[model samples]
Target: MVVQTTNNYNASSGELWPLLFNSKMDDKKPCYLLCGLPKPLECRLPDKQGGVGSTRECVSDKGTIQQRITEWVPGHKLSFQLVKTDLYFGPCVESIIEQFVITDNNQGGCQITRTTTFKAKGPLSLVVAIPMFIGLKAIHRYVFSNWKRLSH
Candidate 1:
């Protein structure tokens, strides 16, 4: 299953990409907690200098998840796949891949599209698909709002 969201900003992709990739998840206050999940205590991304193959680790009291960068295109696109996760939801989720693409608009701004693909563990895991989609959409909105606010 996939959940996608998009938002436009009055800033260039170059201006907004850094805001999303160069910051800690805790600072962004990722919206997972709003979905009845534990808040991440720390989210350590690789140095902004790394490109593809770089890794990021997010830790919460519940557990930690590590992601590997699969694609990187500076100000245009960034994508990663979940490599390992010990979080509570790991048992129900098999895999996750997320991508963010930014493109210039005719209005002299940029639009960012975030897509998240999810693979459930089994038939039983389908039960939570709706909630997962809702949570992911909320997370994307929260992140986009933060980026828009900070781009100025």
Candidate 2:
């Protein structure tokens, strides 16, 4: 199952991409918090941009997940492939890919779309995707709200 959450903000990609790319954990904190991840989020990424093979680790109250960078386009897009996750989901979870795309808008700002794809080993895949979809949206909204307030 593929779940997507999108957001268009009044800020330019140049302004937003740095915040997202530089502060990966802080960028994801809103969703993690809404979904019950505690304070002090933990995230680790390689110091070098070794292209697709670069690995990352993210830990929250929900659990920990390991990911490998699949794509990286500075100020444009980023994508990661899930290598492992503590989210058992009845052991039916096979893989997950999370992507964020930033595009320049003609309206003088930027549009960022987040797409999360889930591949399940069993029928319960939807069980994980649904809540995740909702949580992702909530994260986007929170970010947008804060971005607006801060940009002013």
Candidate 3:
């Protein structure tokens, strides 16, 4: 068994993650991580307008992360834990924690950086670790693209 992951973030003025964290949409529905999965997009996210909240919805079956608010510093930083992607494998995937920071770039803009670290709980996690890391970077690209579209 092997795990592969990739990660990265883009620099921008306004922070999209913080916006989602503070959104007041109906049902408090957050900007969820879209699972390339075919089903009801019930976005896995915490229940800001419902019952007991869990750090559960921040992961998807299609190698993605969603609604998670682990550690927050208002406008400074936030930490989100992504749930494992593979659900059937005996070892599955590793849980990854992403630390996002928003800072002044000294150029009249803000730099948004995301640092992700992985922790394997079971199975042969090293065999495909590279691929898993790459996958994370792939996802990060999508994140930025979406952010760009939303910002515009």
Candidate 4:
């Protein structure tokens, strides 16, 4: 399953992509709390070039979950692979591919388009994808909204 959205974000194209890539989040707030534990927060990406399947771990109240940056092209493309854990459902591999493209909307501002791809495991993918999408959308929205607030 793949989901995509494009928003103006009311900011300049040159400026927005960098901020999105390097999420300048302050850990002192409730939103930052989401980044920890049983529920995945925002990702904390690697600062340097690393090979495939490089895993990053997170600890939650439920258990620990792992993520890896499987692909990259710097500002233009990035992907994260979610490692399945015994604490979640059954066997599963999930990833989100985000692309930040700059386009001239031809109005006054520019557009930052985010495309997300969701890939699942075996037979139960249909049942699982729906709920998984719901969670991802909600979390993504929360992070963006918080970012807006902080910027102002």
Give TM-scores for every candidate, taking all chains together and pairing residue i with residue i. 0.83, 0.69, 0.58, 0.60
Assess candidate 4 and give its lDDT.
0.53
- The candidate, 1 or 4, that scores higher on TM-score is 1
Name the weakest run of 10 consecutive residues (lDDT summed) in model 1: 23-32
Residue 69 local lDDT, model 2: 85
User: Model 4: residues >4 Å from true position, as ranges?
Assistant: 24-42, 48-90, 150-152
Better of 2 and 3 by lDDT: 2
Local distance difference test, per candidate?
0.78, 0.65, 0.47, 0.53
Which of the two, 1 or 2, has more TM-score? 1
Compose the digit string of candidate 2's lDDT tens values, residues 1-152. 66676667788777776544333334445654454633224456746443567876665556767789888777788788888877534266677788889897778788887787777665666676666566656655655555555444
Q: Please, what are the lDDT tens digits per residue for candidate 3 over residues 1-152?
A: 22222222344434555443432212221234533321212233365532222453433333333435577665566666654344332154456667667677666556566677765554556654655565556555445444444444
Candidates sorted by TM-score, best first: 1, 2, 4, 3
Model 2 alpha-carbon drift over 4 Å, by segment: 24-44, 48-50, 88-90, 126-129, 139-152
Per-residue lDDT tens digits of candidate 4, residues 13-120?
555544553454444333443343234334444543333565544343445545575665543444555565554542554554544455657786566565667776
81-116, model 1: which lDDT tens digit per residue? 899998777878888999989999888999999999
Model 1 gets an lDDT of 0.78
User: Against the true structure, whose TM-score is highest?
Assistant: 1
